[model samples]
Target: MDKDTKRDLHSLPKTLAELVGKHIVAAGLLVDEDPERAYKHAAYARRKASRLPTVREASGIAAYTVGKWQEALSDLRAARRMSGRDTFLAIMADCERGLGRPERALEITNDPAAKDLDADERIELRIVAAGARRDMGDVKAALAELQVPELKERRARPYVARLFYAYADVLEELGRKEDAREYFARASSVDREGVTDADERLAAIEGVELVDSDVEDGVVWTDVEEEADEAAAEAEATASRERRDDKGRDHRRDDRRDDRRGGREDRG
Candidate 1:
């Protein structure tokens, strides 16, 4: 390997712990995309500095993303033990959700300890908590938690998307088809250029054929529907065999009656 090619990447920090912390922060941002990779980076960071709250929090988030619920909980516990701060409470709540303990997440969001958080932090906490509440079939509670005027008036696209999606999901679950459709459409329109997933969904909701799937009977059939073709072929073969057997039985009955008639005629 060329020494020049092995040059320092990302401007190595003066301190080894700082370099690890920076890597952990970078890995935390990748939880939604490359969870496994994020977990590896987070684990590396924690190995370098186990007492760092930020590293443990990043590990918790990455573990949650990769479906390691117990590991996530352990990381978050270590983070809280080290700092006693709520820097990553939202992600911790997400861990609880992944672990099938959404109610516990909700309880943490509602805890009095969250009252001292800043405006932005408060909103994030509420959103995370509401997600848990929504998962537990408490639509009203989730909506109530987010109905504050401050949050409603905010113009953050990501937050708006979260609110819209949560509201739409609740309405849809409650059989309020029109309301849910309207909210979903609103969410879809927040980004109209199709540069994001929300925009694509908006195009879909507005009757635009963006993906070429024709929906029928509340189900969509796509280009890769070979599984259905196999099942249909098997059904048709079974039906064909049944019909052939029925026809053979009818022919045999007709021949037996003809033989009986011939016997009677000979006797006469």
Candidate 2:
């Protein structure tokens, strides 16, 4: 857990604090690999410490991860109220969209509190708002909504690639194939971490087909195949890290049990 979460739990009795902290830690650990189990952990923490805003936040995020839209929206709203922070507005708006309430999502973007968000948060809101417009079958309006100056930046920031990709996707939706291809290429170039599948989209636009090297008939090698291999390798690496983290937690639990048994022996 982070320092802020620890501080929030400080007011609880020691035993209760320890239990909630353990659940929260488990939730964080399992969230990526096993989101359903992570949601269970977060829910356990919420049950134990219902009054804690951080616990509510954790529960909300876990619910979101697991696609429990209603639960996520309720928990996130409670968290926002308790914490008096609008940091999760983007997720909240997304949850609204998840519930098929695009109009509600747009309403959230227009909220007075939205103005207080930082630059990154505002960009996130614009993205969601554009998505909401798309949900309403207004592709042109969606494209217009994403026409922020940040989208035209020459250098790539983490947000820029996603913004460009979103714009390109909207362009494609509106039958602007050439523009879509151009923007997809631009997005792919800036996407150093391969966060978006911009490369794949660009390849599809250019009618480039990729064939697996292990195919029996004919194997065609292309840059797209190399990119796919890299993506697979990265995914495997992430899974490996998650496994290591899970093992580390189990070892810690075993050590604690051993310590308790040793304490009993010492007392005897």
Best by lDDT: 2
Q: lDDT tens string, model 1, 35-109?
A: 888889888887876666666777787888888988988898887787687766677777788778998888778
Give the alpha carbon lDDT tens digit for every residue of 57-163 in model 2. 99999999999999999998998898898988988999999999999999988789988888778878889999999999999999998998887775766578888
Report each candidate's C-alpha RMSD, comma-separated, in the order given. 9.9, 24.2
Q: Estimate each model's TM-score.
A: 0.61, 0.76
Candidate 2, which segments miss by more than 4 Å at Cα? 210-268
Best by TM-score: 2
Superposed model 1: Cα runs more than 4 Å off:
1-15, 18-32, 154-156, 191-208, 211-268
Error of 1 at 215 (Å): 26
Stretch of 10 with least lDDT, candidate 1: 1-10
In Å, residue 94's CA in model 2 sits off its true spot by 1.0
